[model samples]
Target: MKKPLMITSLALLAGTFLTSALPDRFIRDQFKKAEAQTELMLAQVAEATKTQPVGKPALVSPRTLTDAGELHMVPARDWTSGFFPGQLWYLYEFTGRKEWADLARQFTARLESEKMNAGTHDMGFKLYCSYGNGYRLTNDPAYKDILIQAARTLSKRYKPKAGIIRSWDHNTAKWLCPVIIDNMMNLELLFAATRFTGDSTFYKIAVSHAQTTLKNHFRPDNSSYHVVDYDTLTGRVIKKNTHQGFNDESAWSRGQAWGLYGYTLCYRETKNPQFLKQAEAIARFMLNHKNMPADLVPYYDYDAPGIPNETRDVSAASVMASALYELSTYVPKSNYRAKADAVMASLAKTYTSPVGQNRGFLLLHSTGAKTFERDVPLIYADYYYLEALLRARK
Candidate 1:
């Protein structure tokens, strides 16, 4: 019995060693693959640039491929416009390569005009992801000015009565004051704006929006509603709708990811216990869901009718993994890092594109919505996957 116990202990120690070693190996391989794929993507971008009409801001940045297998690009006004540049920024951060920084700067410069486009609430998604990463890496004074201006434009959508930034102007017929859980993500811009300019109004607005979302957007179980319509005049709730979920009551996977990331950042920026508690609760709701797959990537909607047949959203997993890595630092005793590792490993092993496929995107099978961009390689998916890898490296 003593001899058997000694052998068992040795086996357990070996297993732990292998487990700890896997992530380092995985991270290195993924970065190598990412660099190769990014090179292919850059070639594609260069070809696309040649076709751009003169004197217009070229939409050369890759967003995703269309269903027909052709590359799709969009102008800076598109919500997804910033992610490709953000990926370039991540590559620069990972490699410390001057070439990557030069490419990132070129692509990032295309979106500078979006700083004044206040018609939508995606200022953070558009500016922060592009210029925000650039600013972080370079501290370019011009980048700081653009970010501050973008924050000011984003602030224009904040209604004091509703206590939330309005998410859309096009859907006004359906909602008087629509505030999606995604709006939580845009708050980071406001917080950073305050940090850059020492303006408390941005900080106050961000806290107000976060507090309002915490109070109204979450279900009893901490799962979030996709959209919460507010009475702009009365500061009252009108309805809770799920624009991208299986149903109004179902948990949209990416929405949950957004909530988790948003609250985690909110806590980091403000050190508010409520935000931390909310972040933990959201994390619990996601990780403990019965529908969460063994691979740690969730279905497009947790309550989608297909269950085992439902499409997995790699984008959501990527975002969740990135957020969890940061969240783990805040709550070191929690299982967030382990869970993040599981997700990253799964993504690297099964969900990543081949060395030169999927139009050079790093990730695959990300659903943009239940009805649109299903099972495609989204640029944001790749961006967040790179972000998670960086966080893991740290």
Candidate 2:
């Protein structure tokens, strides 16, 4: 009787220790380590980009210096334009370098003139990352103006019939106004615009769009379809297609990441219970999948099932890492923070290449889509990876 009682007590104590005592200290230590790593990484990047030539202004601007002492520009027109200004924003924050500030301003001006338009569903990436960071770092009103104009243009894509923002406009079509998982990310601009302009209209529209997605796009288990079409006249889901995934019903890894992150952002902005719940569900579904690589990066789709030649997406890892960090802040008791921290450490240690100035790209294996020639080291991966690092810094 005594021995059995002692064993029961020990089991109870162990449960208490794990369920309460261990996690607080563990989270603190995890944050401390992540902060230290961010400091080192920032120092390394600053040293590398410090003496290198800015190089001639290419339509595709050169972003980083090579390992061989050569200046190599990351191409323009990629989703990474958002990140370049952001990197400069960090440089300004770290070193207080006026050059970084000036360069950021110059780039914002260039990108605003070139890319701001209605057809872009990526205003958050294109504007928030560049102009938003510009305003945050330097307090330039011009950046704010650029953002406002971009917001108005993006808001124009809102379809009253579908109550969702349309993502693409191909040459053959006239505002064929469809929604993709990727659009969740772009809606942040509207949400941010609402904050800036004191306009609830943008906020309302954004929420309606998100609710539409919640109702139509996500599966019973909270796994998401990549693309869902809507009938313009009747506002009904026309079809679900796997534009980037393996099949209509298949889970596209990055799409899942986007929904997880985007819904969380929406919840953060609105405190909407549904968005938060959806984020949690999607996060669980994404983390539980067997197809995810051990390092926490995922192949383009979970059901890329039999494609031995299927490629992994470092972008998915980066986006999910950012989402995990945000979700960690929002849902503290879920142990989601632990998972996020682990993913961050894995991304920093494993996927990061040591070849050129931290590889001039944070993530190595990203698949853009079949149409964009597939499985490339995408700029958006670099963007989100850096954004995650910055979030940890904050």
Candidate 3:
């Protein structure tokens, strides 16, 4: 009788322990909802893209037409052609559909053939999603070579004197050599290229740029500025200003996100304590800001004081969410994980379109190149949004 009673107690104890070890049902439910949402989004994409003409997916807009009877989609003006295949890739992963893979392959081929001869600040978007992802998914050497080539080309743009990659080749002599916070996120492909090719030069340039940014871009409180001009000859930071934000000292939401993720990547790749510390500082600044909304998505600028003028950028939330998840590994297991999980949950619930169909070719609300247009869906937003989802699932 005593033995049987002891066995029963042990069984009860084991059952309780196992139950407690399981993930919270609430979190699991959020993932389920996200999965359902992704499925729905795929359906919508299929419905929308199915009717359109399919030969290499012509870049078209209602406003533009070329003399060659083709819709003229400007290069820098359109930053999302590379992200178009991501929706297809997501569908392929979920549904195991060959058509989706084929479409992804076709998109990758098109991007490779087109090349980045045009001047743009975002080769990472052009190559990472299309070629980097294709190489990861299909193990195609062709895609890998394209990525390697793209990285090599971008690496050439790195100005040793400035210790950072140039942002744009503008008509004005003022911005002939500029560095933007956004370049931090785009430099990962270069790092990856270094890893793949065993070329320290790529990593050297990438790390130098990040180190330069750490010195110049960071504010007193760890918030970041958007753009900084450098002396093309002296490697000196000339000016720091908010090209897209409310003012020079204002905190741009996406810039904060970029710092959070970029520094985290720097830490991961190089294990530099400074990078980790910077990442945490930026994360804390973002987390503690009074201006951010409850959903974790932030206005274009945290310093923007008005109501109607304030605009929430879902892209920032997505990038931060992904960065925080990576950051959790380095941080002690505590509220940080919960914080990261909660941010991801909000992104999955609030920003994710119903059934995942995006009308603007974006998963989140990103104010595209604010200098050019007031607000539009930018391609990198979709790229980062998908990257966060993938990282969260992993």
**Top candidate when judged by TM-score against the true structure:** 1
Q: How does model 1 fare in lDDT?
A: 0.88
- Please give, for residues 285-331, the per-residue lDDT of candidate 3 as tens digits: 99888887765667778888683467677677777877887897898
Error of 1 at 170 (Å): 1.0
Question: Per-residue CA lDDT of candidate 1, range 1-394, in tens?
Answer: 0001121211222123223523565677778889999999988777766787668666757888887877788778899999999999999998899999999999999999899998989999888999999999999999999999999999999999989899988766898888999999899999999999999999999999999999999999999999999998999999999999899999999999999999999999999999999999999999999999977899999999999999889999999999998998999888888788778777765677766666688888889888898888889999999999999889
Alpha-carbon TM-score of each model against the true structure: 0.94, 0.79, 0.79
Q: Which stretches of candidate 1 lie over 4 Å from their true place?
A: 1-22, 53-57
Residue 167 local lDDT, model 3: 81
Clashing pairs in 2: 62-73, 356-359
Ranking by TM-score: 1, 3, 2
| Stretches of candidate 3 exceeding 4 Å from the true structure | 1-77, 114-118, 307-309, 356-364, 369-379
RMSD of each: 6.6, 9.3, 10.2
Shift of residue 33 alpha carbon in model 1, Å: 0.8
The number of the candidate with the highest lDDT is 1
